[model samples]
Target: MRPRSCFVRSSLLLCSTLVFSGTVARAEAPAGPQAPPAPQAEPAVEPPSAPQVEPAPSAPAIAEPAQPAPVPAAPPATPPLGPTRPKIDVYVTAYGELQFAYFNYGLDQNRAGGAQRDSRIEFDTNRFVIEVKGGLPDYGLEAEVEVEFEHGGTGSAMELEYEEFGEFDQELDKGGEILVEEMFLSKKLGANAALAVGRFYVAVGTLSEFSRPTDYLGTNRDEAETSIIPNTWDEMGVRLRYKFPWGLRLTGQLVNGLDSTGFSSQLWSAGGHQRRFEVQRATDMALVVRADVTHFDGFTFGVSAYHGDTTRNRPKADLVKSCEEANPREVAPCGYVSAPLTLLDAHLSVRKGPWSAKALVMYGHLKNAELVSQRNARLSNLLGVIRTPVSDNALAVWGELGYDIASVVGLSDSHHLFPFVRYDYADTQFKPREELYDNPRFRRSVYTVGLSYNLMNVAFAKLDFGHRRLGSSAFRPENTLRFATGFNY
Candidate 1:
C-alpha cells in the first residue's frame, strides 16, 4: 500500500513541470501581425542609465578588419657635388696714342756748337699700355699690372762706332723699349689705409701721379720734369698710402736709387733709370713722400719730396775716395764718397666748368756733383753718355690753361673742343759748382697754343704749335708743329 502511494506522487510532480515549460515556450514565440502602438512623451527629469549590454544576434554578417595609419613619404635623393671655384673680380683696359710732328731743330741738339738750322719731321706711336686689375674682396687684397709698349715696342739700328782713333766698327743700337710700367699687390689695412709691394711709379712728380692722356692738355708730356728725372719714373719698392676724410691723401715709398754714372749736363738724372742690364742694382735706396689735397670739386693741389743716395748704384763701385796712406793689399773702393740726390715739387690742377689748368714747379739738387762729373768723364768710350759736366742744381716750371670752346660755340657736351695755351721753362743746369760750367743751351722756354677735340674723352685729336727759345738770345729760336690722335679706353 505505501509503495503505490509514493509512485502516484512522483508522477503528479513530473506532469506539473512539463505543463509549465510548455506555457513559457508559447509566450516567447513570435506573434501574428498586429496594429501599431501610439508614441509616448519623454520624461521631464532624466533617470540614471543601466550598465551596457551586448545585443543578441539575429543573423550572420561579414565584416572587415581595421586599417593601420598611413606613413609619410621620404625626401628625394640629393645629387653629387663638383669642385668649387674661388670668387675673384678682374678687369682689363687699354689706351694708346699716335703722334706726328714737324720741328725746326736738329735731332742732336747737344752737339758742340748747338743745333743751328736743321728741319725735320717725325711720326711716332708714343705709347700703348694695357692694364689689368684684380681683386679678392673677401681677403681685402688687390693687384694691378700694366704693360707698356713704347715707340712701337723694340727695335734695332745699325750704328758706326769710331770712338777710337784708328778703329771703325758697326754696332747694333737698342732703339725702343717694351716695359712693365707697373706691377703691384696691395692689402687694405683698413677703410682708409693700404700697403703695396713690387714695381710701381715713384710718387715724386705730377707725371707719375696723372699719366693718362686725358689727364693733361698738352700734346706731349711736361718737358720740364722729363728733362731732370725719368719719365714715368718706376722702381721696385714698397709703398704705404693713407687717406683722410677731408679729401687728403698721403703716400710714402722706399725704392732703389738712381745710378749716378749716367748723370750728365744735358739730361741731368734722366738717364739714371736702371735699364742697361738684365737686373737692376739696389745697393743704394731712396725715400719719397707725397701729399695731395682734393678738397674742392675738380681741383687738386699737392706736394712731394724725394731723397736718395746715388754713388753706390754704379756698375763697378768705382766712385770712391782714395786713402791717404794706401796699401797694395787693400781691396778696391777703400772708402765710398757720398753723393745724394734731393728733389721737391709742388703741383696744382683745376678743371672747373669750361676751364681747365695745370701747373707745377720742380727743383732738384745733387751733392758732390763735381766728383760725379769728373768720374763720368773718365768712363770708357763704350758707355754711351753725353760725357758732359753735370751741374749741381736743376729747376723746372710749367703751366697750361685751356677753355672748352665747345660750350662757348654752342656744341653738345659729348663733343669737346678745347683751345689751350701752355708755357714751360726748364734749366737742366740751373746752377753749377765753381769747377763746372753751366751751359746756357740747357736752359729753355717754350710757349705753345693748341686745339684739342675729343668725343667724350674716349677718342681725341690734338693740333699744337710751339715756339722754343734758348737762354742766350744769340742762339736761334726753334719752332714746332704737332698733331696727335689717341683713344683712352
Candidate 2:
C-alpha cells in the first residue's frame, strides 16, 4: 500500500472510533441551515412594492364608571341585657348611741336649777330590717317584704311620747315586737305603671320616711301631724303608681284603716287577752286618698285626706255583767258611740342642690267625742268612773330648713357640715286647770337647732339645742341640750 493511502485510512479509522464510541461529545451539534442563504437571488434582486393603506380618523375616549360604596358591618350585639348587679343581696347594720341630755328648769323658783345628769350610754339594734326583694326570671314577678324591729319599753322614759328613742335590747320574740314594715307584690302594668297589693306604708306626708341618722333635727312624728294622718301607718291594701320620664311619680292606694283593726281577730289576739279584754270600743271603717307631685331635681308637694268612724264605748266595769256578756253563744251588748274622725294633711319640700326646706300642716277633727274615764280596767279600778265626753279639733304645723355646706367649706369628704332649724306648733285639748271647764288650749312653739358630722354613713356625731314652751303660765319653759355620738355598720 502507498504511505498516503495508509495515513488516510488511519485518520478515517480514528474519526469513526470517536463517533461510534461516544467518547468525545460534540460541542455544537450541526442543525439545518438557520442562516439565510446569502441573499437569495430573487430577494436581493427586487423589493416588493408596498401596499397602499388609508389613515383612520381620531376616536373619542370614554371614562370608566365609579364603584358603589361597600356596606358596613353592624356592631356586635350588647352583652345579654342584665341588671348591673344581681337581684339577690344581703346587708346587716347596727348602731350604738351615747347621748348626753341636759334639762334646765326652776327659773322662777330661784332656789336652784342646774342640770339633770340623765345620760344614756347604750346600744340599739336600731333596725334588724330583713328585706327580701327580687324579680323572678320566668314569671317576671316582683316581690318585696320587710320585717322591722320596733322598740318597746317601760318606765319614765318609756312614758314619754314616741318610745322609739331608747335602747332596744329585748328579743323580738319577747319584749321587742316584730312589725310588718312593708310587704308588697308588684307587677308592671305598662312601661311606666305598676300595680301592687299588700300591707304597705301609707302614701302621705313628707317626713314619714325622711328620718335618718344624718338628720340633725330631733323629734319624730309630731303629735299634731302623726296623730292625724298617722305617718308611717300601714294597712292591707291595693295600690297603683306611675313614673314619668320627666321624673315625676304619682301613687294611689285603697286600704282598710283603723276600723280594720277591731275586725281582725289576729291583731286582737296578738296583743293578748289583757288587751282584748281591755279594749271594748273599736273603729268601724275608713277611707283615705292621697296625691303627690314631684318636680325633677326640685320639689315635692303632697296632700292627703282621711275619714273614719271610731267606736266610743267603755268596757263594762262589773265583772258579772262582763262575764254574762261574754257568755258562749251570747253576743255582748257592748255600747257603741259613733263618732266621725276626719283628717287633712298637706306638705311641701324643696331640694335645691345641698339646701333643703320643708313645711307640713295637719288638721284633725273629732265630732261629738267622749273620753272614756274608765279607759282601761286598771284606770277604772283606780278612778271608779267609766265614761267621759270629749269633743275637740286640732291643728299642727311644722317647718324645717337645712343646708349642707360641705362643698362651700372644706370638710371631710365623707362628712356633711349641716346647720338646721325646725319649728312646730299645735293645738291641744287637755287643760291643767281642774276647776275650770276644759277649754281648747293652745300648746305651741318648738324650736330646734343642730349640727351633725358624719364619718361615712356608718357613724355620726350630733349636737343640738332645743326649746319648748307649754301652755301653762306657771310652768317654767323647758330647754334641752343634746350631744350624741353614734356608730353603725
Candidate 3:
C-alpha cells in the first residue's frame, strides 16, 4: 500500500477506536471530478439559444399579516413551600406549694393553752398558679395572664372575719378558692418604656413580685404587708413604666382603691379587695408610684407610695342607714367622707454571692378612721368583727438574712441549703384616734428561723420554727412549726 494511503488508514482506524468512546469525527475534502467533459461541446451548446419570452404579468402583490407578539417564558416554579414561624409566640410556666403547720405547739403552749388555743396541726395546699405569656412583634405588644388556685377547692375558703382576731385559721378552708391574679396587655413605648393596661399587681411594695409562696424566703409573707395591704394585690387599671439603661426604673399606676367598709381593725386594708362581681368598678381610683434603684448587681433599693380615696370604694347605698343611726359627735357620717388612705414603703434587697438579705419598712395613714370605725361597729359578718377605736396609723418593719451553706462549703452548685432568720413587727394601731380602743393583739411581732434546701433547682423543701409575741410582757406569746415543699418552672 502507498504510504499516504497507509497513513490515512491508520488515522481512520485510530478515529474508529476513539469513536466508541465518544470522540467527535472531522469532515473530509470532496474528491476531484472523476472525469473531464469535452470543452468543445460546451461552447457549441452556448451558441444555439437566442429567443426569450416576455414575463407574464406579475401577480398583485399581497402584504403579510403582522406577526403575533412573542409569548413570555413562565417564571421558574417557586421552590416547594416550607414550614414557617407562627404569628404569635406563646410561653407557659407554673408554680405551686404544699405546707403543714403545727401552731402554738411549743413547750409553753403545751403548758398553758395545750390542745385548746395553743396546739393545732394542719395540712394545706397552699397555692397553685398557672401563667401564660404571649408576644406579637408585628403589633409591638405583649400580654400575660396569671391564675391562682388558693387553699385548694371550689368550696375552698370560707373565711369568717370572726374566726380569730390575729391568726390564719384553716377552718375556713372547706375546699379552695380561685383567683385571676393578673391579666394585662402592654404596649412597648420605646426601648425602655412600656404601658400596660388591665388587671395587674400593684407596684407598691416588695411583694409586687407577688405574694406567691415561692417569691418570699420564709414560709409566710411579712405579716405587716399582708395585714395592711392586699396579699398579691392586683387591680384593674393602667401602668406606665420607664427604665433607664443603668438599672433605674420608675413606674406609676392608676387603679381602684380599697373599700373602707371591708376594712377591719385587724386586717386594715387587706380585706378591702372588692371581689363581689366579675368586674371591679374604678369609681374610686388610686394612684401608686414607685422608684427603684438597681444599678448595683444583685442589689435593689426601692420606694413606693400609694394614695387613694376609700369613701367611694364602699357601697353608700348599703351603709346609708348604718351611718345615719351611729349619730356620733366625734366623727363624721358613716357612708361618705374623704377618708383618703396614704401608704409609703421603702425596701432593700441584697444578694452578694452566698449571702442574701431583705428588709422593708412601711407605714399607712388613714384619715377619719374614727368615722369608719363607727360604721364597722354596727356591721357584722362571719369574716369581719367590729373593732372599736379604729386606728389612724399602721406601721410595719421586717428584715431577713440568709446564707447558702452548700455553696459556702463548695458543694455542687445545683444543690443549695440556706439557713435564714427573719423578724417582722407590724402594728395597725400604732396611733389610734382618741377614745378608740387599741388592742394589743394587733401589735404583734414574729421571729422566724429556718432552713431551706433545693435539689437541682426545680424543687425545694423548707423547715422553720416561728414565735409570736403579743401585748408587752403581760401576754404570753405563741409558737409554731412549719414544713413546706414546692416546685417551679
Backbone collision count in every prediction? 0, 1, 10
Q: What's model 2's overall lDDT?
A: 0.51
Candidate 3: tens digits of C-alpha lDDT, residues 1-489: 454454454445444434533434442322233213323223422332311211222212212234566889999988768855559988998888999999864444223323235477989999989999999877678999999987887532323233465332324435677888899999998789999999999997788964655456687777767878888889989999999998999999999987777777677877778764334656678999999998999889999999998877564323343444676663335644568889999998887888878888999998888778777776544434344445789888898898889966778889878899999888978878767777776787899999888776568888999988875665676788999999887
lDDT, each prediction = 0.82, 0.51, 0.75
Worst 10 residues of 1 by lDDT: 35-44
Candidate 1 regions with alpha-carbon error over 4 angstroms: 1-84, 110-113, 155-174, 324-333
lDDT of 3 at 413: 89
Q: Residue 462 deviation, candidate 2, in Å?
A: 2.3
Q: Model 2: runs farther than 4 Å from truth?
A: 1-100, 105-130, 137-140, 150-176, 215-231, 244-248, 259-283, 312-336, 371-391, 430-442, 455-458, 485-489
lDDT tens string, model 1, 256-309? Answer: 999998898878999898876556788899999999998899998999999999
Query: Considering TM-score, which of the candidate structures 1 and 2 is the better prediction for this target?
Result: 1
Q: Write the number of the candidate with greater lDDT, choosing between 1 and 3.
A: 1
Error of 3 at 373 (Å): 0.5
